[model samples]
Target: MSDAVRKIIHIDMDAFYASVEQRDDPSLRGRPVVVAWRGARSVVCAASYEARKFGVRSAMPAVRAERLCPDAVFVPPDFVRYKAVSRQVREIFLRHTDLVEPLSLDEAYLDATAPKIESPSATATAQAIRAQIREETRLTASAGVAPNKFIAKIASDWNKPDGLFVVKPAQVEAFLTPLPVGKIPGVGKVMQGKLQALGIATVGDLRAHPLEELQARFGSFGAALYRRARGIDERPVQPDQPVQQISAEDTFERDLPLGEFDDAIRRLAEKTWLSTRKTERVGRTVVLKLKTAQFRILTRSHTPETPPASLQEFTEIALALRERVDLPPSTRYRLVGVGLGNFRERDEVVEQAGVFGE
Candidate 1:
């Protein structure tokens, strides 16, 4: 193992939801598929490659997707099945290394420096993982192998469905040079515009900019930009990271006054409670989040001496927290959210007194 370098692999499922739908139904294979609920207000959860050719995309309104691909087949998302498949994929990853960081149900970063499997190299490990996923799930995945996470993430996308790309440490700088600044993580459209204004259109241009000048121009983010331009990122793939919060939110088709939020809050609370039940940790704080029609965000939270004992109790607490909102009675809200925070692992709470002798 090289002391100064780490081997990271990013694996991403191709058109996850749409692919799953295609796999389960023979009739849907080789067809443009859009995964989303059928409703005027519904947005696409995923779009198959066939749909992409017709300009359909994830998060696009379903009606627009229908316009883009009139022959497209629409399938609602099946999160329960998705979660099961995700667990199967995670099990496969754990067979390689425990150092797996999941970004979503269909994508993860795996530190393959010391894989459990006796692979000849990180590239080989990535190949084997991709092969296993195909053999086991009848699904395809794209992989990127690199010296670090960020580059691995970018490399993973260089190839489309069922492809692999590798970036050796020596090739990092060369690979990043001509890449647009927007390709760098965290440099979104707005940031790209700001950098473009300064004649920093590519990683090479960003590299040439003086560190002091970048600092002055972009504040702390400037330092990050400088490092990224040089193909440097030190983040590690951490598994079982602590949960800070769990929340569920929704945007309504039409904004409604505060008095009409009861049903929304209850629905969000039920969603949040379902999510919390997936973990052994218990959250002591119940939070109510609201976004006004004008886009102003407000939150109210309460921490009781004990965590809510049941989903009903959780919903009750979330509903009660709504009364704490001091916004004008006539204020209309476009979004409502329910959340749980200040979590403690069940075992941690059980052993606290013994460990501290308290």
Candidate 2:
């Protein structure tokens, strides 16, 4: 909101998951690689730049990616090792500024307007972080430095793998006007279609529309779109914000029978627990999600005062939720998912409970 500009930097790892695989395996270096098991039901976690050249990408089914890149080497995902590397990278970031907000394991925003060290500018801070990642992790990171989060985030992707781009306060409009609407965050396939239908296909096009008209179409999100299109984002770099929940879900390739539900829920609960453990947080609720063969979704949740802290307790809650479902034996389902919620720091649980009379 102020005319005085701030220095924000977004650092994104270069094809992070696939890069990890290539970094570890001598044979995978400089090769087209896909990180996924070979199966029709399997989804790609990441694809190397070489693999991406053949139109492979994350979340695309491995079966389709294989058809796209016939010679691509498939490697199983090892999230455990990936997280380890991510932690190392985080430490590197902390050495510069505590205003680091991790978007995921692979990307983060750093507010270095006034960093711990007297860096001349945000660009220098970004260069240091990128260089540290390369030296310590043997991987590359792309960085964008700008006056705000929205501009910086978009600039980070402009140059591609292992590149850096900058967006100065004076040049924000020039950098954003020619970009497509989809390049703005939150403008996915459906939103893009909506904008396209309104004859607003580019950032400049959106800017031409009246704020009132945009608001009528998109509610509060319209205002956000207007700001982002103009390369303005006031969101703070929230590194200290506590995580509220952790969840994992799956969309089944085909509907599964009720008899098969128990095993599926068990597996999902285990997966959720494993993921939550990585963040070192405990949850008070267990959630089970089900989707019918016809795409009807149902969710069941339980908040036990004493949340399950072990695999045995995890399985117990999941089985209990499964029993509550009234689907017939022949009824089929398309998806099953499990999750944990109402999380808090382990050390603060006692105080949290007392405040809530738990």
Candidate 3:
């Protein structure tokens, strides 16, 4: 929206986990693959493009995915290897620009207003990045280049799986006008339904609504909708954002009572602990999250005088926090999660302790 423009590129890996599995095993190159743990309660982490044709998708129950594609090869996720590959891809990004913001192991946003390499334009930089990824990792990536982060993120998906799309500054309005409202980030199914009820199905339709009316109807999000509908995003690409929290959650096939949640809690805690190990900071607060069958949500947290010293200590604290739940005894929960927060670097923790004369 500002006359001063910024160049942002969004890069996303193609079926990351499933692609990694296929890349490592030549026998799986052209076949449908589903990455997931082995259990009735497990959910799909990633589904290859081939499996997607059979209606299998990430987060779907493994049992349902199996039913959808009985012949699909099922493999467990190897996050350690995935992380290593992610680091390799990140190094490729750094060669072009330092303003790289990793969204996850498979996707990132890069500000290429001034690239390190002598490239004529952002599009060229993106092409080189993708080519390097394929040559080095044998993996494909999709890239989108636009004047701003919001539009760039949408452009990235236009040409997926080893493709590139670009949106110039002058083309922003024309590019956004006919897009469905659901195409905008944060406008999920529920929001889409609400907009549909108001006869607003596309970005053009949303533009017809007055700002005041949109604000009155959808609260603060209405303002965001108004700007995004016009392809006006002013957010900058940040590279040094700190980790605020680390967590892992799972949904059960059937609701289970609180008394039957011990195993779930332990598993989630272990998963959360694994994630924390990837960072340099340690978490001092342990949190337990739950969702009842009736859709009610609850959270309980504990922050001890000292941060958890080990995975066993972190798990114990999370499990003990479960007893703090005050819901009805008969309430059945459909989801459970464990989290660690209030993170601090080891050096900072030591400095604080010394300052407090502890």
Best model number under TM-score: 3
Model 3 misplacement above 4 A: 1-4, 246-299, 303-340, 343-358
Q: Backbone clashes per model, in order? A: 0, 0, 0
lDDT of 1 by residue, 175-223 (tens): 9999999998778766788899989899999999988999998889999
Residue 25, model 2: Cα distance from true site in angstroms: 1.3
The regions of model 1 sitting more than 4 angstroms off are 1-3, 245-358
Clashing pairs in 2: none
Give the Cα lDDT of each candidate: 0.86, 0.83, 0.88
Per-residue alpha-carbon lDDT of candidate 3 for residues 1-358, written as tens digits (9 for 90 to 100): 2524788999999999899999999999889999887676567778999999999987677889999999999998787888889999999999999999887778899999999999999999999999999999999999999999888889999987778999999999999999999998878776788899999999999999999999998889999999898888888889967788999887887899998978778777766765675555768899999999998999999998778887679889998987899888989998898999998987997787688775
- When summed lDDT is taken over every stretch of 10 residues in candidate 3, the lowest stretch is 273-282
Write one digit per residue (lDDT tens) for candidate 2, span 1-358.
3423678899999999899988889999989999876764556778999999999987677889999999999998776788899899999999999999887678888988888977888899899999999999999999999998888888899887899999899898988898999998778766788899999999999999887888998999999888887776778787966667777666665678866667566656666664565564568888888889887888888888766867668768867887778877787888788888888777777676777783
Model 1, total clashes = 0
How would you order the candidates by TM-score, starting with the best?
3, 2, 1
Q: Name the candidate, 1 or 3, with the larger TM-score value.
A: 3
Q: Relative to the unseen true structure, what is the C-alpha lDDT of residue 162 in candidate 2, on a scale of 0 to 100?
A: 92
